[model samples]
Target: MSRTNIDIDDELVTMAMRLYNLRTKREAVNYALRQLVGDPMTLEEALAMKGVGWEGDLDAIKGGGPIEDLDDIDLDLLPQDLGDLDARDDR
Candidate 1:
């Protein structure tokens, strides 16, 4: 195999090493390339997934369990404020 050298920022390299538990740049790049092969638009069997991605259910609840009937229930018990967020710091 042919050998090649690529340059990258030291900060990014350090971050990648900590995030991926990799001690080398070659290992990080190999893992990144492998993850790009997964297709996000492919059709899959419903039973094949135990906890895969899913949209809003038609006849079910949002956070699991049975359906919540909204016939005569009060809906004013939810929080509507972003309270204590001072500001977003742009590092």
Candidate 2:
């Protein structure tokens, strides 16, 4: 992985560490980046989900979203669920 070093404000770093219970700055940064990698979004796309209930959306809670436009996540394919998957092809 390419390491791009950048300066972050101390206050911001402190807050991220506290919010995530992170022991090192690298851990906090990595956690946040990993959460963000699956769904890269402009700020505008996230605000659209402000009013939705959180009964079933972990991705939205972690990354914020409009939900409707998230095409990468397949909720129907949860591990315990077979849904329409072929019973013969053991996944």
Candidate 3:
């Protein structure tokens, strides 16, 4: 590791320390850098990993198939009243 002087925000460092559970500023900085620079993945790897456990229909999206529109939903089937949502009678 090479030693270098750089200006960093105190609030950001403290936040990173709490989020990453790091003790020192150095550890927090390193963890934050690693998070910013994530591991690279190829398109083939990403596509191959798709539909592992997904239950949705892939054919609907593929071959430019007709997409379902949600604008024709029946709102009357929904509940009319939410009972006892707020028990506290403070006005």
Candidate 4:
């Protein structure tokens, strides 16, 4: 809880706040620091995460099955040439 003043980008801070759903700049900064330093979860916390279940299709999420070789990959299924993303209307 040491208070320090330093020059920081407001836009970056705002983007961090939105991305992490943090209420304050302090929270966003702290979260970013934690992520940068690699925050390790405790054993209890890791065990607790086991209770969280996934109800989605596992195979579909895994792209059919285990990719053992590069030759097995379907070239047609992959994105061909996504040129000039700025010209896209979806954004």
- What are the root-mean-square deviations of the candidates from the true structure over C-alphas? 10.6, 16.9, 13.2, 8.4
Model 4 Cα displacement at 46 (Å)? 12
- The better candidate by TM-score, 2 or 4, is 4
User: Which residue pairs collide in model 1, if any?
Assistant: none
What lDDT tens digits, residue by residue, belong to model 2 across residues 1-91? 6777888767867888886567888877876786668747546536754676345556644455555655655655444543656844843
Give candidate 2's whole-model lDDT.
Answer: 0.65
lDDT of 2 at 16: 83
TM-score of each: 0.36, 0.38, 0.42, 0.45
Comparison by TM-score, 3 against 4, better one: 4
Report the C-alpha displacement of residue 66, candidate 2, in angstroms: 16
For candidate 4, the per-residue lDDT at 63 reads: 80
In candidate 3, list every pair of residues with a backbone clash.
Answer: none
- In candidate 3, stretches whose alpha carbon ends up further than 4 angstroms from where it belongs are 40-91
lDDT of 1 by residue, 1-91 (tens): 4678878667766777677567798776665555578635323323444465444443333335443776533334333364545643522
Stretches of candidate 1 off by over 4 Å are 39-91
Backbone steric clashes in candidate 1, count: 0
Best by lDDT: 4
Winner by TM-score between candidate 3 and candidate 2? 3
lDDT of 3 by residue, 5-30 (tens): 99988987998777546799999887
